[model samples]
Target: MTLALVTDDMTTGVLKTTDGERKSRTKLYWKRRREALSAVALERLADLGIEFPVVAGTMTIPEVCDYFSISRSTLTNIARQYYEELIEAGYMPGSVTQPTRYSELALAHVAMILRPSTSDQAMIIQKALGIYRAPRGAVKVHNQSGAHVKVCGRVLDEAYKLVSEIREDDPEEVWKALEKRNRHELQVLTVALAALVPNDRGGLRAWLAEIGLGIHSDAQNKAAVGLASLVPSRQQVSE
Candidate 1:
């Protein structure tokens, strides 16, 4: 065997570094290559209908490879090399043992660009937006107002009490006494209260609306027109 083939200059089996270097072995300057797809590679991915978003809970890297007829190693190389750009492009991280999922935006873009069926396209967009269909029979709502309605017993009892208490034959005296207490302000308040039907019983308001005499009875609203008419109009006062 030749002497050069068997020997290292340092005698430690490594060639000594030159130019006043301290190392007995030569240093390696790593050649860094950006881990991004070239234009051709990107075009290929697009042609394969692969989108770029990292939709959560969607397919894994292996699944993606399967769908696109690609190998895992190729995808892994892209990920390992161009991780930053991938993230900026909305790639997401994988959890536990799963591979990364594409984002909603990515899924939707792929679906759109691939010209899938209308329903499938909608589904893809929904998936990308993280929207899910409500499961059948998840919600059952009942109309409570239509059921179990009895005439208000308390209101009836109160009315009975009011009737029993009003034994006086002269209601004018009572009316005068009430008006004197608040000087007609009480009448205004009572009118306002009467105009507003707070109970959702669909009784008075519903009936009025059905009869073409809704609470907003006229163009200015029935309540305003009616209330205003109760006071003499400007034309009437001028006359």
Candidate 2:
């Protein structure tokens, strides 16, 4: 019985059976790609001594715009996208009783979202925030009996603590926070290999073959070729 692993491209899907064994590397490839990208971004942040701000109390629209150097429209757009999140984080919204003002934490989050970084690093920050700072049970999982279960708020407790405790003068602590959040995507050696020979399909295939993750079909080879583009080049940067 062939198990059809669901992916955007069925032919190049994950966990498909090939030659009497389960072998597909799409997930691994993306995981490594994320790690490599995150590492580079994290190093840059450390070098720049970029400290995520800890502005306390609430701030009105003009104050936020001035401090962050962002447009009012940009803040409105991001606030709308994270409206529910802002409320849950104790940031007050404009109402009959009170004016809308954002918590310092909310402002910090907005800065994180807007920080200049590569796509993968952005994704990592978003996911980490969702998992650690989001409202209770942001993610759900299926149990052994296929019953949907809410993940505990404390699931990423360590990473959450690390992020919350990052110090201004301690760049190493900043690195640790991001690295902790990116724990699941950790695959340093694999990412190093991908970087060393990004264009060498034959070499990649050989290396993967030795490790039992080789492209086993024409469809997968095509998929692998396309996936190679996901690996960031030396010059990949935000516009």
Candidate 3:
């Protein structure tokens, strides 16, 4: 009878593990997995000059996956398991009920758990988060030659008008919209402009100067003028 019972248990493939034991093992696995993924993701961010701790934007699930190059299922698992802690860290905490939203600081905390204090990457990111402050003056300096003029008056007003016509969206949104223009469109525009202008080299050079595309050197200007002579004028094409 005992032999028959052992065979039945073997056939059923049942193991004698308590719920607590299973929970503990699963929690341990999650911890190790989170640490490994965080190490890889943080390294990539560091290489890209982005420290996660100080990054300001909140990210949706898709954005996070794209930014970190992590699989959606893995992120779902991590976020689900740590939902409460994420909520404490300012995440909305409805991953199971609604879309999961994550902030940079929350992601930093996820890495901090079970991660060694001696990790240089982690230390650097944390240090920047803790002590870094925005500068009061200009963060970037541009080198200007004698030809460059500061934007003001009518020039500034025209620039503002141009920007509003291009995009009334936020700066990043405007950049994203501009990024949709491919190289082919630029080539087509260049060819069309070159064709429309009259075939006179001096006239082409003058037009180029007016449009702020004046060739820097006499040699380059000569080359541009020569190329213009080769392209048929709009009147020539009509004939």
lDDT of each: 0.42, 0.48, 0.50
Tell me the tens digit of each residue's lDDT in model 2 across 82-167.
Answer: 67655655567777876678765555455455533322333344454332123354332213342212222233343344334432
The candidate maximizing TM-score is 2
All candidates: TM-score: 0.22, 0.29, 0.27
Top lDDT prediction, candidate number: 3
Displacement of the residue 63 alpha carbon in candidate 2, Å:
0.5
* Residue 131, candidate 3: C-alpha displacement in angstroms: 20
Candidate 3 wrongly placed segments (more than 4 Å): 1-50, 53-56, 93-99, 112-239
Q: Model 3 lDDT vs. the true structure?
A: 0.50
Q: Which segments of candidate 1 are over 4 A away from where they belong? A: 1-57, 104-239
TM-score of 1: 0.22
Lowest summed lDDT over 10 consecutive residues: which window, candidate 3?
1-10
Of the candidates numbered 2 and 3, which has the greater lDDT value?
Answer: 3
Compose the digit string of candidate 3's lDDT tens values, residues 1-239.
01112235357744356666677886677555444544355555566586653334666777665645455764566677677766666565554667666776566654444122323344454443342223355323233444433422334444455446433445445445444767754444344445444443355455334323443445546646544433455676578
- Which segments of candidate 2 are over 4 A away from where they belong? 1-56, 117-239
Candidate 2 — worst ten consecutive residues by lDDT sum? 146-155
